[model samples]
Target: MILILVKLFQGLYVSNSGEPWVEEAELIRRAQAGDPAAFDLLVERITPYLYRVVRRLASDQNEAGAIVQEAWLRAWRARHRYVADRPLSPWLVRIAVNVARDLWRKKAPLDFADLGGEEIVLPDPVPGPEDQLTRKEALERLVRGVKKLRPEYRMVIALRYDAGLSYKDIASALEIPLNTVRTHLRRAKSVLRLWMEAEDG
Candidate 1:
């Protein structure tokens, strides 16, 4: 029996190694076996990507951080239901995005005075003398346009562009139909393009 169990585990490992290293799949396997260490690994691996997506959805850094922390806790509690054969990242991201949306809705309406903090603090904004003003203006316009997007459209766009998720993955993460993902992306692009053109004009 011992030898059989060892062989079975070895085979499982080999099969898993041959497959893709998606976040959900690995976490499911480890979590199913009650491995806390694997859960931690999953969190660390997805944190940076999740942070960017959450940040894009949130109005500010503080809110984004709070949402992300809540998302992780949610993921932890839900780990028992995770299916090991599926990709874990999308499942985790789906939860995170939902949490972000909830926080966005729960936030108090912003006051007009809150708009006073308009200065961007990115490092090295001017790389060269040529095209500096044009590049800066374009980037600012893009940020403004993104910020103005509706929550659903912004979430999908951020997941696609900022978090680098495929359409299928985004669909899975957002718990929406694949066709809806395509629709949202299409609408988001049209709106962003119009916004960018208006800014340019």
Candidate 2:
């Protein structure tokens, strides 16, 4: 929200072409004035991370998608209420998590096996003779490592690494305090590091 990263670039006058280019102020102004494109850009910029958070929180794929879609619609409908000066991702994710939580609450109770499931079982598919072995091996290892993690740790790692969010940003987006973010990262890294070491051994 404070644009601290941009402050350093201001001195060098270097611009980021790859970073989110939508001007926050301009987007807010347009959205407030009922411009649809501005609202669309806001959704586009935030959807990936918001989806990831919802997927982590939701009980299944359908619920995750539903929550994300509901959150976006609600956000768009309530766009005028959003403070232009605030960070959008946190605001958006807050809406998403709340939606997911509400959905979760409405569901019937589940068995422990359904909630805290064990490692996923996948069929050993037969590959063609010409299949790329190296890529397959690498992917298998990545999946194994991820599957070994606790769901909570896995969600933190996915949100931070796969979603490319900073520690502070993740903390805000997930609605957790800064120390909890650091704790989750620490635990996730430690788990991954141990898994890698064991694989090497």
Candidate 3:
């Protein structure tokens, strides 16, 4: 199965002009019908986005990769339960997050202190060496602050910013209410701001 999945992933960019690519909904429908190729296509398209979501919770690249693969396997098994009309990303993200959470439980205590793989890019209106240096420093501080956040806050932050998920999508992914998502984000930002301010002082 792993070899097949790896081959399908490698073939993602292979030209298939002979056949037009199917729409995502159709792909999902086909996958639900147990079409392996359709499911592989879904995996190819969704893995990058899902990895970003998983990386935020993972300790390192290898763990992140494992989490993503396990999530895909679980997704394949649960495809029949997936609602075809609903968007696929949030559902997949939820699975990935849960997988990471379960791994955390089995390992040592969950610690966000080392969650530092994703690059943070800040746009500068006036681009220069000095501006670039400042942005880099700010990004470093922000990442440090994020590492200090509670597990739930870190999850929301990862889902909202790294994964680029909407509030509703984040709520769905985390199995929480929309208001709870908003509250966590708000509180997270506030804590980060306070942490940064204290650092400056």
Candidate 4:
């Protein structure tokens, strides 16, 4: 599986100007019929986006990568149940999120201090060293704030922001009502804002 993942990552980095999901339905059909090559192709194209979502929930890259791999393995095993006509991302994201939640149940609380290295864009494009430092500090504080949120709120925030899923998609992935998704996001943002403000003062 590690060797297969290494090959998948190699394909992920290659420049493919074509549409990522142009023939995704056909690929899904083939995969559902037990085509490993077709399934590998789909994994190659989708892993980067999946990794971003998993990375937000995981304590570190190693945990995130493990979750991603396990998600794909589970997806492959359940391929027969997936409808080719439906959008694939939500289904896959649901699996990844479930895997993360399961892991969390067995481990310590999530640590966001490692998240400070993630990029944060400021309004000033040519910021000085001081500005850069300030941005990093602010991002660290925001991550710390995220750490304090309830598990459901953190899941909604990661799905909505890191994965860039629509509210409806988040609802589907989380098996929750659309209104609940909206409520969680609103409350989570409010809590994070207050936490950041308190930290700044």
All candidates: TM-score: 0.69, 0.54, 0.79, 0.78
lDDT per residue for candidate 4 within 151-194, as digits (tens), equals 77788989988888999999999999999888777777777776
Candidate number of the best TM-score: 3
Q: Model 3, 78: alpha-carbon shift in Å?
A: 0.2
The predicted structure with the larger TM-score, 1 or 3, is 3
The sequence of per-residue lDDT tens digits that candidate 1 reaches over residues 114-183 is 1111222233556686668867777777777777877888888888988789998888788899998887
Give the Cα RMSD of candidate 3: 5.0
lDDT per residue for candidate 3 within 66-183, as digits (tens), equals 8889999999999999998788988898998888778877866534332222233456646788888888888889987776777788789999889899998988888899998877
Per the 3 Å backbone cut-off, how many clashing residue pairs does candidate 3 have?
0
Please state the error at residue 199 of candidate 1 in Å.
2.6
Candidate 3's C-alpha runs over 4 A off are 1-19, 107-124
TM-score of 4: 0.78
The clash count for each model shown is: 3, 0, 0, 0
For each candidate, C-alpha RMSD in Å? 11.0, 11.4, 5.0, 5.8
Model 1 is weakest, by summed lDDT over 10 consecutive residues, at 111-120
Q: Model 2, range 51-118, lDDT digits (tens) per residue?
A: 76666555566666677788877887888888878877767776775676566567654321212212
lDDT: worst 10-residue window of model 2: 111-120
